[model samples]
Every structure is written in structure tokens, then in C-alpha cells.
Target: MKSFSILLAATAASVLPVSAAVAAPAKNIVLVHGAYADGSGWRGVYDILVKDGYHVSIVSQPLTSLTDDIAATQRVLDKQTGPVVLVGHSYGGQIITDAGADPKVKALVYVAALQPDVGESVIGLAKTMELPNGDVEESADGFLSLASDKFVADFAADVPKDLAEFMKASQMPVAAIAFSEKTKVASWRSKPSYGIVATKDLALNANLERWMYKRAGAKITEIDASHVVFISQPRAVADVIEEAARAVK
Candidate 1:
């Protein structure tokens, strides 16, 4: 509670309207982090959305289990006083898919995340498709990690070297088994969906990203960046989230 921060300052470029129509409230935004990253990485997108007069909250996931991450994100959603645009990055796709089932969630935005449907899992999807994290190293205790040496090239290829290095140093370690847990529901199935597909992404297969989006019937936008497109390309990411906000009805 005390650890969570609410970003209210405006900084990033504002979003354009989709159309003039009666829609749900787009005042709240909740961002969920994926594995090998944390909420701090959402600073850029947070600034953009907050500046546009949206109340933005970044969920600090425990990265220990799927249930824990979803619970943490839901807790953040619970604090919002109005409809929320739930956005997730990387493994956070799974988190939002689970947490976004809440009635307060108006829509969903996936940024280079693993969008697993009901009865599917993170590892299950990756196992069927080719992922870009070939250099990721798992520990003996079941926590999965990315090598700091290869983290920059594999996860944040377009990001500056210094920032990528800092991300590697502070990245969260996710429980390897979390990837194997099946999703009970995919909120995108019942909610409006938007996606940011990273063309240069190496951690996730671009085709798989598109496949998931297409299946979910998401409003898709492609960006030429790496896995951490939220950092390398915050504008596009924020724009899609805003679009999701606008799509609410």
C-alpha cells in the first residue's frame, strides 16, 4: 500500500480520439509488469498516460507465482474509483488476463506479452512457438533469469546500453513453474482488447504475438523494437493503452 506510487504528472504526448461516442470512463490505468522486469520500467508510459489526465497505477508484482502476480494486480485495480484500462507487458499479459476479469476493468492492452487463453500457460505457449529468449538461463532453484551479458541484445536490443544494463541489474526473477500454470480465464475473451506487437522483439516470436492478438480480436499496432518495447517505444505503447481507454463502452 505505502510502497505503491500514483503518477499524476503529464509528460508523454497525448492520445488522439478514436471517435465521438458514449463510452465507459477512461480515467484510470493500471500497468502490470512481466517477468525479468518490474513496475519501474513503466515510468515512461506512466508519465504519458498521467499527463493525459488519467490516473495511472503500476502494479509491483512479486514475480513468484502466477496467482501472486494476478492477486497483486487485482489489488491495484481494487483501489481505482472508476473503470480501469488494464495494460500488461511480456509475462504481464498473463497477469492482466487473469486480473482483468474484474468488473472494474474496461479494457486490456498487451505490449509484447504472452497472451495465453483459458487452460493454456506461459511455458505452454512458448514451447509451441519459438521465443527470442534463447540466452535466458534458469537457476537450480526453479527461478528463471536472463543473463546480464546477453540481456541487452536479447531483451532490449533497441534500448541504450546503460539503461538496458540497469534493467538487467534490477530485473525481477520469476518462478519457472509460474509459466506452467494454466490460466483459468482470459479477460480479453470478455473485454475489449488492444495489442502492441514488437517487430524487432527477440524474446517473443512476433508471429506468435500477432497470432494471439488476431485470435483475441485485438486492435493491433506493430512497432519495430525489442521485447522491452514499453521502454524502447513508450509512445506507441501508451497510445494503444489510450485507445483501449477510448474503446471502453
Candidate 2:
């Protein structure tokens, strides 16, 4: 962790201590990534959370359909030893919305992610926002991906150019139809949620990020970063996730 963000987290922790009733925060954390990205992107945030004595797990959700992604997350959830703090980024939000209803899930954290209601979909929710041009590229075989050239600019401008370029080349392919798949459940309705809004995000509207978080009634945090704020601002992101975890301990 960077010195500044460590201090930033400490300051935030001081201002908001854990409640007396929470004997211990949920020890298990499950991280879910969005489209065009994979579980590896969560390494930085994972390290911070682990260092804080939290047992963390990552779900490699295949970007096929909402049901497939939810199934993938459930596999991980089923193995947890205790209640889980379910975290999602971008498109992964809907996955948690569905899987988070699992009895093992205790909390949710959204990192500039989509939060839809029962029967809502990524495409339906996207229609409410002004999406970036060239941010999405559809392959002939039907998989959707991020445009390599625009990735750094739209997805990870806060990240270094070299790392951003590498991420572009290694991008995960999401099924284009995933966006149209509606969620059958919205866990945010039944569970407490924490949200992070990337102020400089271009791929998803910053205003829409605010709107969705507000709609979910989440405790919100804002950062001046692109969509991949988790990579560029891992410490701060981890802090917020930790905050949500601590509340449900």
C-alpha cells in the first residue's frame, strides 16, 4: 500500500469505527470482475484486504450470461467458511445482485459497477447512460471486448501507459448477449451495500454511477479516477470494502 492511501484509510477508519455489536467483521471476501477484465485485475486490492487479516477469494465469472456468471460466483460462495463480503466491479455488479442473495453473503461493495433490480439488465441499464464510442468491440464469433486503443483512455487512464496497454492486449472477452440478460434478483435490496464512483470514468457515465448507487441506497465513495479505479486506487478501494466488511462483522 502507498503511504498516502494507508494514511487515508487510517483517517477514514478513525472517523468511522466498527460498531460494538459487530464482534468481528465477515472474514471472507469474494471479488467479482466485470466484462473485458479478469480476476487478475483484483490482485492489488486482494493483497490489501489479505494483509488486513481478511480471507479473500476471487471468482472467475465467465462473461457469458447473467446466469452463468451467477453460477460461477455461487461455486466460490459455496466454499466459504463464513459470511462473505461480496464485491463487484463494472458488469460484475449484476452477478452479485443475483448471487448475493445466497445465505453466505453478508454485504456488497460495488466498484464503479452496475446495480440493476430484479428483471433489469446491463443493456437496459446502459440505455440510461451515454456510453463511450469505440469502448466496445464485437468479435465475429459474438464475444464482446474493449477496443485496445481506447482502453487506456476510457478504462484505465489513471493507470500507467505500459500497464494499461498490457491490460488491453490481455482483455477478457464477454459475450455480447450478457448485457441483455436480466437479473432475477437484486441482492442490494436485501443486503447493505457500499459503492465507489469513478469521477473520471468515461466508459460509464459518472452521473449514472451516482444515480445507480443512490438508487441502491449504498454508502458511497467518490474518487477522481477512471473506470479501473481499483487498479489505480487499490488502497482506497480496499478501505471502503473493509468498511463494509467491518459493519457486518
Candidate 3:
């Protein structure tokens, strides 16, 4: 009688509905940083996500060209063992918009980042609306960077002064042509997307961010911070990313 009971339990388990076995939530996160900043700026977001049991990786893209940055992002995506919630900040959004098309990417999160549609370039979009701060500097060799004197005011008004200075000192200069290079694809169309708009941003127009996120149909979160929203409001930024991660499955 005991043997027969065991056999009946095994049969019932085999016939259980497939819905009982839900797929695991994505645990990997890949972060991409925009021009003028390195992956280190994602440190705050990284620490928060890690503490919550996520496997996070940050891509340090060379600001030489959009194509090169996309390739750098892809290399990091390739190393992720499972599905990823890809996140990008500032110009890094442009990189992820292209690289997020990778099959490994399950969701996208843009933090005060640019999201250009096909046939659009960063320069083209930025030109659509005037930037609040006019302290951008272009080198004779065709590289672009924020003026050190205005970096804090224009890019990180909410960030502590000393850290902002350090960020300015270590800023990465981008190839001027990168802003003019047109986007080849808009990955958000195929993936679930979330966006954080830094309402007080001076580097990139806040209204432009709204327009782009609206066009992409991303779930948008507005934070009252400077251009470096992730740095200033890491908890809020991480919450949006976690929401995307949980909903992707």
C-alpha cells in the first residue's frame, strides 16, 4: 500500500501545470557609462544592486567612437551567463540602444541618457533643443569635453563639490564625430524599457529626455537632480532598474 501511494504522488507531480514552474528573474545587470565619465560613476548603483543579490558588471567604454563603444558594451554583454537588464547613463544610452539588441539583453534602463531613434544622432537631437549650459569645450583635434570650471555647475550641481571636481579631472573626452554619427537601431522597440529623467539636468535638455522616452515607450521616472542623476540619486535609479529586472520575465 505504501509503494502504491508513492507511485500515485509521482504521477500527480508529473501532471502538474507548467505554470507552477516559473522562470527565474534575471540576476545579471550590465551598466554602461556615457561620454565624459567612466564606469566608476556607477559605483553607488552597483553597490546597492549587489547588496540585493544581483550580479552586476560595468562596461568602461572608450569614448573614441560610437562603434567602438558599442563593441565594448557587447563584449561585456557576451560575458554575462544569463539574461541581463542592460542599463546606460548619459551618452552610454546611445551605446546601449545599439548594443542592447544583443539576444542576451532582456530589458533596458536609461538613466538621464540619450535614446536616439534610427537616422538620429546625438548632435542632431541636442540641436533640436538648446542646452541650458554652454560650457562645452571642443579640442582642435575634434574631441569634446566639459569645461572643468563649469563641470560641477553644468553636470553635477547636486553632487558634492570635491567629488565633482575629481570627476571633472578624470573626465573622458569623446570624439567630436561621435555626436554626429547616426543611430543604426533603436533596441527599446523590442525590449521592455525604463527611463530616469533628471529634471534639473543642464547638460542634456530634460524635455528632450521626455520626448525620447515617450517615443521609445519606456516606463519613465523623473528625478529632480542634475545631469548625473545616477550619482546623485542612486537609490531611485536602482529602484527603476530593479523594476525592469523583475518584470522582464
The TM-score values for the models, in the order shown, are: 0.89, 0.90, 0.93
For the record, the alpha-carbon RMSD of candidate 2 to the native fold, in angstroms, is 10.3
Clashing pairs in 3: 34-92
lDDT tens digits, residue span 1-249, model 1: 333322222211222233322344588899998999888999999999889889999999899899988999988988998788999998999989988899999899999987889999988898888876677788999998988788888888898988988998987889988898899988898898988899998888999999999999998899988999999888888888887887677
Two-way TM-score contest, 1 vs 3, winner: 3
Q: What is candidate 2's lDDT per residue for 154-220, written digit by digit as tens?
A: 8889898898998999999999888899989888998999999999998888788899999989999
Q: Indicate which candidate wins on lDDT.
A: 3
Error of 3 at 91 (Å): 0.6
Residue-level error in angstroms, candidate 1, position 50? 1.0
Q: Please, what are the lDDT tens digits per residue for candidate 3 over residues 77-159? A: 98998789999998988988999899989999999989888888999999998888888899999999999889989998999
Please identify model 2 stretches exceeding 4 Å from their true place.
Answer: 1-22
| Model 2 worst lDDT run, 10 consecutive residues | 15-24
